[model samples]
Target: MSYAIGSVSSQDLWTRLKEQFSTVSRTSIFQMKSNLQTIKKRSDNVSQYLQKIKEARDYLSAAMVHFADEDIVILALIGLPPEYNTFQCMIRGRENVISLKEFRSQLLAEERIVETHVPNPLLSAMVADHSSATKGSTSPFQNNSSPSSFFSGGNRQFNHTKQKGRGKFNQGVKFNRQS
Candidate 1:
């Protein structure tokens, strides 16, 4: 390291250092801005995602480069996953820009709604199986057995016989007509 031989005032030395190292600050600011743009929510929860964004903003602030709250809000929305598309549209469509606090609150609420509404894979499979099984049945109550057999406790002794007909009521019935 080189040392100054003459006594240098602290202010003079600070000025000299900053003038020499100004490029470092510019590079730091550029990198931080790039990082902010590329951030993504991916697997992180709402809070974690917001925290990551706020940290990047904080770094920019430390480097004397500050973004407006609206800009920050836009950045946050841009980094959201596709599942939040509706929420992003809502925010973008607002007449007034939302504060960061309100944005955070709404985002968390939306996250809860999304979590609650997500279909369970197992439940979905069960429903799909049930619908496929019942596809051709005329009535929801119709199962493997004939209606009489189904209602009569599966007794095979019943005289009911299957017949081609317009409806269930006439399927196994006999009617006499008098002229």
Candidate 2:
């Protein structure tokens, strides 16, 4: 320890000591910022994800680097998985900025909604039936049978007759063609 201290000049020793004690290293700050930017909510719930973000923000704060609530909110939103797209959009489209507290509450509520959601059996069956019915056909209207056969019903033929002077505009018109 004495040798190490003696190697540094007295004039530079105080300055080095002050820098070490008073300042956060640039690399440490960069690492913390990177962590904040790339944080993901892959399998975590809303509360866990929010807690991670809060921890990162707190670390930055301890280093004397502070982020606005809006910035933190944005970071949190961006970290969310695709499942939260609608919720994320709702939060982003708000006219007024959302406070962190409000954001947390809203996220928890949304999480509960998502967790408690149940797929309707009838709806699921309908979807499955529709998909199976249309699996081999490119267009819904496409069929293996002929158009005439498909629409066969009632009368097979129609009688055509032209009437003269059927309307005010046709009063002066004459029908010369036979049907």
Candidate 3:
């Protein structure tokens, strides 16, 4: 080791050894960055997602790639699933930037809310029935006076409505008809 380093002292040799062992390649850095960008919150809780981000961020930091708290927040937001779009928008539209701790707390709260409100079948059915009943009377096709109306002349066969719920927030109710 000293032969290669040209008569380096023990401390210098130790430092050189540490540098050699700890050096990260550009490819490694790029790969870590890519992983950071693509790591998503699918089927994982907020804690898991945050842990992954922290790991990637720590790797980048070890490689001497620094990210500001704002950048970290943005990257974390990008890693979230499509369901978090509204939350992402809310964070982005904030007049004052929040700290990483605040962001984590907010994200965890939102995640909990999302988890709690997921598809209560009984409530969903009630909402669907209510919406359908309201729509039934107000449907333009229900006007028997209109020549183009399918409900005219008691032709109720063509007035069928199919309800399919995907159970994702406001999109939980779907109405389909076969013509």
Best candidate, TM-score: 3
| Candidate 2 similarity to native, TM-score | 0.57
lDDT of each: 0.79, 0.78, 0.77
Question: In model 2, how large is the Cα lDDT of residue 136?
Answer: 68
Candidate 3: which pairs clash? none
* Overall local distance difference test of candidate 3: 0.77
Candidate 3: 10-residue stretch with minimal lDDT:
150-159
Off by over 4 Å in 1: 1-23, 120-179
Which run of 10 residues does model 2 get worst, by summed lDDT? 150-159
On residues 1-179, what C-alpha lDDT tens digit does candidate 3 reach at each position? 34236635878766765675377888988998898888888898999999999989877886788888899899899888887888999999999988999999999999987877678799887777657745746744444545444223334334335546753433424578699
Instruction: At residue 45, give the lDDT of candidate 2.
Output: 91
Provide the TM-score for each candidate, comma-separated. Answer: 0.55, 0.57, 0.58
Candidate 2 runs further than 4 Å off: 1-23, 119-179
For residue 83, give model 1's deviation from the true position in Å.
Answer: 0.9
Clashing pairs in 2: none
For residues 13-40, what per-residue lDDT tens digits would candidate 1 score against the true structure? Answer: 6666555445556677788899998899
Tell me the tens digit of each residue's lDDT in model 2 across 109-177.
Answer: 988887797988999987776687567674334655444432443224333355556454454346698
lDDT of 2 at 5: 78
